[model samples]
Target: MGRPSDIPVWRHIGEAPCPPSGQERVTIAIVGAGPVGLAMALEFGRRGHQVLLLNRPDFISAGSKAICFSKRSLDIFDRLGVGDAIVEKGVSWNVGKVFWGDRPDPVYQFDMLPVKEQKRPGFLNIPQYHVEDILFDAASTLSSIDMRFGHEVTNVLPDDDGVDLEVRTSLNSYKVRADWVIACDGSRSPIRSMLGLEFEGRIFEDNFLIADIRMKGDHPSERWFWFDPPFNPGQSALMHKQPDDIWRLDFQLGWNIDRKAAVAPENVEPLVRAMLGPDVEFSREWYSIYTFQCRRIERFLHGHVIFAGDSAHLVSPFGARGCNGGFADIDNLGWKLDLILRGEAPASFLETYDEEAIVTADENIRNSTRSTDFITPKSETSRAFRDAVLELAQDFPFARPFVNSGRLSTAISYPDSGINTPDMDRWVGGVAPGSPVIDVPIGNRWLLDRLGNRFVVLADGWQGPAPDGVEIIDVGIAAETLQLIRRRFDFSPGAACLIRPDQYVAARWRTPTPALVSDALRRARGLA
Candidate 1:
């Protein structure tokens, strides 16, 4: 494919001598250079694993694809060393307003960042290209990540012990063996097709036009959604503010519209002018018509090959679940894959990745499906119900919950996973097994910064020494700190909680013993 004349080309820094045939072996082979693949590379690189990251394209992405980054994704980026840059470059927003047809007032408004004290904002809006650049820069600086741009994977063969890949470059074709292969190739993954994997789910007939424009406007940095608005009659519209004066607009075009004509400048300009006044000057950055689907493969793990991000599952773009869920995949798979590669954990531990990620994908599909159904009613009765909800939402506070513009992606809680230790003692509202650690401030640093990438034993004022391979955190040193800890963890003096490397709580006890802690660690690591 030829590059667009107007788009700027990113420099390629992956030029190097090709490896000799049949002799190259890496601990891991990643099949894409998008956000998920780059993140996988960065995580493994940081852990000192031999990694090869392959991409078919030599240049970076030209336009913003995934614009919304959730707080949980930011936390993952922070752990990978690029969180601050993303936060600094993206437009942070926590408030959203939803309006009904031609009404001068909003029917409902929501605040995503309800709490004042937190490490990251509720979400940020930035072009996906910027995120790729940051991850690419970080990946290039690592010694363990071998980035091979313009190298395409032609075939893959998985075996009991490892996988063999046939790759083609402009110069030559070569074969490489890897202990593990990760397919981050994308929704139209060739690896998936080659492996005869099937993605099963519902495909919505509704089409939407996405336009990114650069303009100077008075619109505040918040999400504004319209249900049957004046600008686009009888359909829903969404507008969001992004960094660099770029604004994203999505206009729903019922399935019958011609996609090519919808994205044409002649048609798109009139829509933009209608929405943003005829006098406002703006230039189009990018435009595309997309049909969304809520789909996923039955399994994410296939022998020695694993799939992440779009290659594993896909969701409608309403709730920003696609990228956020992909980040979750990276977080869940990174440590587990690393441990397995280093022989610290058995290969069967990967079954937990499949179990947990499937649960996450299902949650995303459910929310995205609901949002799609509400936005595009399939029948007259459904439309009437939706309109009725919107109408009542203007006056009745009770009707507001029925409005589902988009739930906005948030962390999914895994309370009943097999890895978690069941509660044996009476406890009130607090972090439980399989729950991500809540962030809290300690003196000058945050609680997350103090926790290591291993098993952690957090205690209020316990004097007993922790078992081997466990890091202890004394939460009772300061009165104010102790108060915050107790409120978050529902803890009294001497209570302890065991936290996993991914920051999920594994177990808690009023009084912990070495035997109990060790057993909990074993269960959490899938060794039990």
Candidate 2:
């Protein structure tokens, strides 16, 4: 068959067992055009490696999936140069209200864990579609990257030198060859199952229904979790405000109910009324019922084939960790691929991808799982404990933290990653030394200002040249930003930190001389 205008032309490499004949070879074959896959493709292409991005033609769909982007995830987008567009169209929410067991007033009215400037913008609620569009657009501009919209992967076969892949489109089957294959195909990932990787986790007995509604109500845009919801005892609903006055409502479906019957207008209208009371007008825009299961792949990689995003780990969306966790996977895998492809590092450098991410993925799973349990307790004892704790929260402010059904924190630090030292005294406000969030001001500049380039090391005390290849800033903070930092973080003028490309603190020291800062940079880059 004659090649279509959009059909990718392949060039041949040495004989490989998987693909008998392929005209083209690329460094990597990334499956799925979702946010995670696009992120990986963007990073690889920007680093001067040949990349192929493939997805089934039917993959694109309307409706927003995830709406919240954490600082850690946003930081990655910043590096990709698409973060500003995402932030521009999204709503920033810092204060989340938590109600305890049918209480009229929220027991916990606020949390500021991932503040933008400590006292400013924190988390933003932008639809997942907007983020994907930005990343996809950025990837499309790179000549090194070839994006195939209708392509579907039939098989991935790894050989001694690289991986062989079979892709099927409408008119023909194409054999493609790549040095590595990264699968971001999602939770029910065919590639992961094909690899015989085990996904271990319990499927929750409960189901939740999410609907986007155009409701004129008094609901504040801030996240609101109704514990012990009146509509259904032992269950709750989460409400988030999206762009264009659309409200995203998530309701817990009681076990044994026919999932289809619950979404009928007859059944849904009453629940909305009960939750909104008599003084609201609303109509459903879109709706879905999801049964969440917390699961993670036993291994992040098998030979040259690797897993990421929902393909590698699945989590409850309680803290917006699901896609964000996958985004983190892309960030971690991106630079490492650059290093290995450039012959600057050994392939073993890629091993840390599994080490740091799998551990972080498991942590995210655990945190989201606990949030699910707190909101929907399965056993009598746990229910009683949950109730008693909420009851006590009425009288005691100390017990208020228990009402946190959502683990809303801007930073998820890997304190144990050899890159972070716990004894570092620079961290204040109980900041995890490993997960670095800094505040830098230069002529009204703020922390996270101009951060999307690469790993940065902040040297406050040392008046010396930074390492040969890293970005260094002598953060000269204005008095107001400094005051804001003092209120938000505990850092002295002499402290310095080695931040990773993704903005997490690789290492820090209380009294960092040039020598110590240099060593930290070396250690962070695995040079030490």
Candidate 3:
């Protein structure tokens, strides 16, 4: 990998050469300082808990890694107070075009943002390094967050009451006792390995070469995908424009190629030049070859030790599920851990985090596996079917659904979660009890912006008193906006919804008594 002079580098205030330290005690210890680890530290820090964030690298990070971030990710970042900053620097996009062979025009095109009038765009493309920099900067403002950049965890030993960790630096090793430990390391998690856990899933045989090059590209911000293109025959290709004049390109390379030689500058130059055209000028910044895999550990929570982000699950880069899924993990686990720490919820409450996150990981695996199969067919019959579907997808609306470039990451509903209060009334069209809340505008502000990180009652002129400690969010708006909210939330007169701290609906009803709302609140807190 090569770094250009254009990209900015970030150094943390706590970054320094490693020397020995004395033993210490902390409330929570988070391993890894990538986007997920830093976000995890921020999640706990904002909840008024002391956290120790550890990373192996001296600097934040470099190169073009995990650039595509989904809408759900933006919402999480917004809650963390860095959403506006990310959107300002990222390349926002909504439309995507799919091409077959050397066709002059795209056979089918689609909009990623199906719903209208949302606060954020459908997707944003910014280098992963920028995301880490922003998250670290936000975490620095919190007194509860203590970040160490050049530290590594040598061992993790869980006892009856808490976990003891051995941390190593350049000169010496020291111990830290933590009531709770969070693992946010990359896919190759050192924490998971030390705990003797293993992932279970399939690793696809196909390979893809990624090339990030700088150039004055004519391509629009929209994502462009091609199948069996002339530049790379019998395979698929993808292209996206980043914030800088950098263009990211991916070319399919079958299983049996030399991984080392494939990334050589001499070999990678021809591929980019051929794809761009004979006269195009460009400079390469990075090149790599990699395989795809969909795998996850069986459980995310183990006693006082928990795993999140790439350490918990992994998905192919096609749908941008990698980092987006990580944000989802933080959103789900943060509130639950906060309640448990305060003794408001039992230890068993953390098990739900294990269940819900596994559900999310499994769903992403199933959908991403399907997309991989469509992009890289396994046999002649499958390839023929895929091509036929692509041919008909251009004109036939029916065939469009069968074409699986990627399912594009979305917030999944947890219908079977134990904490969800099952709906007791008939509903028409609204966010369900276990679904993610829909974003709507209220006056000049967005609906989500008003709902802070706490349990609230979203009522529609219900006049019913909410349970203790639960606040009622304002939904009063202009007639047009009110109508939109009513439609999206099915909030007829007297309808009420109970939303959890993580912005997920716990329960809803058309008409409810005070007793019922109390029961739902208790149930959502894992006390019922």
Candidate 4:
């Protein structure tokens, strides 16, 4: 078979020099060059921290492994300086339609981004390799990042102070030391195995076949899912549009089927022809069979070493939680690690990353598990109930809520966390402490852009002096801006809210005072 014209060739870069034994110290060491690892390098390097990024393989990825990038992931990419490039290259959409049986029309449809005005779309579909390329280009320009391709970490030893890693290459073995080590080496992480960590969770019995085919067609750019369709017969399937006329098709194979035979062209081609008509022309770009699982480690933080992305947790692909959840891990850990390295916060602050990420992992696991259960019923009674809900959803509005093809991934809010200050003000319908702030327009700029990379005090009609490290933005002076702010923050004329560096609300007050604001700032930074 000839290679597709659209696929990019992987380039082989030469090996990097092995560091000396005695003087190989750095601030942070990141293992893997995938999206999550590159994100960690970019985030820490942007803040002027010395970062060593190591990758085992010398060549770039060939296929689109993960296609969906959520809005929260895009926002984090924006902060890392590659958001615009990614959005420009990817296909953006927020609508999804679900079909049951041989129906001529969709039984139900949903809009992910209900609000029209926002900084980013609900999600974008781009080849995972393209995202890694963009991140690699950005990381190359940062002087603080030391990128070492083809150097695999053979051993990781963590002590009370820091970690020591033994890296192996084609020519030589070297020692590297770092104050902190982040394991983003993916689901089959060598670092996790080297430390003898146990990842506890359940693996589903169902297997799925994923195929990426390239063709030119008139199909709309939205997610289309079918449950027990006529073309497949007693199986569920999903179809999604990609950027370069490449479409991703997923078919569920029962536990009894042979995985190798199912992915063979003789079998897969017939299914494709049946679904898209016999006359349609398409070429296979990539194909693979995978079993779904939901799992996470006991804790993300271990002494001087930490885990992020697939190294920390794994979820089924139904909710787009795998990559999106990894991005969330980077966002949660980056700022706190930066503060600790700079002595702005205590070392105990790192514990918050563990506490927060565990809760987030639990949330992702629960959602993914529920979606999987609905999609693949283990018992006859469960299957009947699911079918009934799908059948009724076509006509009744109440039944639409019960229809759970797959709950799309959204940002999870942390309302009751130890990091966020307790509410001391009256608010109705807006972001609370520990919740992410919804993006709103301020004049010609965005409210998030004005927040910058530091703590901020957002108030309406303020007449007092601001703190030293905090930026104060007065929103009540203009009618249009104030109205939008009020609607988004549920603010009155004199209300003020403290926002963290990652754009999460830390505290809110009906009346602003220097003492109270300072206390909130200190508590938010782990000074309390």
By lDDT, the better pick of 2 and 3 is 3
The parts of candidate 4 lying over 4 Å away from their true place are 1-11, 477-481
Reference-based TM-score of each model: 0.96, 0.89, 0.96, 0.96
- Per-residue error for 389 in candidate 3, Å, reads 0.6
In the range 1-528, model 1's lDDT, one tens digit per residue, is: 223355465555543457865668888999999899999999999989989998877677676589999988888888898999999999999998999988888898988777556788888998888899999999999999999887888999999999999988778888999999999999999999999999999999988989899999889989999999888999999999999999999999889988889999999999998888988799999899989898999999999999999999999998899999998998899988887887878999999999988989999999999999999999999999999999899889999989999988887878888989988887898898888888787666777767745678988876557777677888865456668778888988778899987778999988877788888888988888
- Highest lDDT: give the candidate number: 1
Model 3 spans with C-alpha error above 4 angstroms: 1-22
User: Where does the lowest 10-residue lDDT sum fall in candidate 4?
Assistant: 1-10
Q: Judged by TM-score relative to the true structure, which candidate is superior, 1 or 3?
A: 1
lDDT of 3 at 6: 56
Candidates' C-alpha lDDT: 0.87, 0.73, 0.86, 0.87
Q: List the residue pairs that clash in candidate 2.
A: 10-23, 10-24, 11-23, 11-24, 12-23, 79-452, 436-505
lDDT of 1: 0.87
The better-scoring model by lDDT among 2 and 4 is: 4
TM-score of candidate 3 to 2 decimals: 0.96
User: Residue-pair clashes per candidate, as listed?
Assistant: 0, 7, 0, 0
**What TM-score does model 4 achieve against the real structure?**
0.96
